[model samples]
Target: MTDGVTAAHGTGGHGEPADAPVSAWVLGADSGGSGLRITLAAVPEGGAPQTVGTVTSTEPVRTGAQGIDAEHMLAQLVPAARELLERAGERAQAAGLRSVCVGAAGMATLGGQLRAELPAALTREFSVRRIALAADAVTAYAGALGQLPGAVVAGGTGLIAMGTDLRNWRRADGWGHLLGDCGSGAWIGQAGLQAAMRAYDGREGGSAALRERAEAVFGAPLSGLPAQLYPRTDRPAVLASFAPEVAACADRDTAASEILRAAAQEIATAAAAVCPAEEGVSVAVTGGLFRIGEPLLAPLREQLHRRAPHAHLTEPAGDPLDGALLIAARLSSDALRLPQDPALLSLT
Candidate 1:
């Protein structure tokens, strides 16, 4: 048995020798605004793969003129991969990496460089043959529903909804904070802040509760907020940090409650837009934005019922990292069923 590799069904048991050779290794990675996570798993001869090691980095990959900086991602990923391989012992490393699946937040629109370079780069680094570079939304769908006919709304600082019927992918409202992502945490926070500003100006449609919360969070004389907020590169995440304040004030503030309700409507509408019309298709809402809890979820449930009544609301089975691993496993076993796309789920 390898030092770090866990024995799977066909190795060291079930009539197989303890020294049974590993067939291959697969790598799964999820990269997003927050950071990057990589998982290494080993597949034994005629056995399912088991996770051997994992690594995470808090620094997100940088974006440059060409889009997501492939070099930057590789800089973080290669070392981590090497560390995992070394930990897995000689036998597991000898099998080598056979396939890789990387799910990145901007892979659909901002992954030109990744698509153009990642496959060849990975090939050089690990001799990888099969690779799936996917948009985070697609991975979120796979994570939530596992290739089943369903809709998945992933809402964090930004939001996107995706659905598939095993034929093609449908997407909605991932246009970032400036254009869409209507039901996202940033949206809610921006709305809450607007209400707070309105109250400061003695205007209509203002919430005193939100105003107090905002002032408490951002400091007094809220007019100074722009100076504090506008210069940062991570404006979306900063804005989203206020979403919980809105949720916290929902019980006692009419404006806050209304903001959440409207946000829910937008999210449900996005979900419905991508959801298969067939009855019983699963719908899942995933990500940190949903953690605002019943204040947001209760309204979201009601809105989903109204908008996607034929769809069954389901809890997410896993997250994007799990989805990437699932895709890698399927690719390794030659059982991948998700439809291929140029931008959303590119295969090589």
Candidate 2:
């Protein structure tokens, strides 16, 4: 909480009261499958931006549920944002908290009561005059490309590819785990688990090491796999957890290596789907997949070369939290003029 610490270090003057308006700062947050990331910066009149606070907290995963689950999702999001608001203290009233922008995982598919609920909660809590809500992938692209005309592949628990060249914009994948999200962590994990089950039954000529690993995790014969998954609320995360193990075993297990190689291909193909194979476009790669290094990246690099050789590939300039801030800034000016999508909620 950078801003909180700085505010606390200020003069002996009293802090802003809880009931006052937060009018001087802009906040950006990334809400994802596992957690929430928030960053705040104060924009004083005619002065350089001063970063004040940032926070990371756990939150519910959005699995594309449209009704009651959407309310439940808001139930999780409000508290994380509230924590940041409270950090601003009475200074929220003094500095006069301004606008907030939030990017969540399934925002592209968002609608219904949940969409309406989030902005109301933010306004009431932070007393900000304006709010912007967008798909985390939108911010991811902006943050990764620095708002340049390029494409970005965001590979985390799920996967999505988005690209823009001012004149046109395109998006691909991000269909979620049930139908798509190929080359995502959940996708790789599912592939590994299926291979393990096949080896257990001698069905796929799978790797013994993979089978042994599964047995060790799920008990002998692995008969309890369904029991482990069926009753859990966080089934996707549970399944996606296996991806790290798959990547770890890729060097010693054939099935694991094949799963990673295949996952890489699928993700690369997704990137190519949204980005044209042109000479001028540059693509940035982000998310946990990049963190796994060569085991996954080697194949992805090869696939990208083969699939979209004319496009350039590079590391992201910043994470999604940064994207949130970048877009919020854009909204204030006409910077890159983000397109209006129904999934996005803009309150001013």
lDDT for position 250 in model 2:
94
**Candidate that would win on TM-score:** 1
Deviating ranges (above 4 Å) for candidate 2: 1-24, 43-50, 59-95, 114-130, 276-278, 344-348
For each candidate, what TM-score against the reference? 0.90, 0.78
In model 1, the runs with Cα more than 4 Å from the true position are 1-24, 43-49
TM-score of 1: 0.90
Model 1: ten consecutive residues of lowest lDDT: 1-10
Give the per-residue lDDT digits (tens) of candidate 2, residues 1-348: 112222322110123333333235677777776676666655443222244566666644545446324555555455645555577666644654467777877675654544667677667766666677777888888678766777899987888898776555688888889989899888888888888888877895567777777777777877779788879887777778888888889998888999989988998788888885558688888988678789998998899889888888887877787778766655544343666566643444
**Which number leads on lDDT?**
1
Collision count for each candidate, in order:
0, 12
Clash count in backbone of candidate 2: 12
Local error of candidate 2 at residue 256 (angstroms): 1.9
Clashing pairs in 1: none
Residues 297-339, candidate 1: write the lDDT tens digits. Answer: 9999999999989998999988887788778877887888889
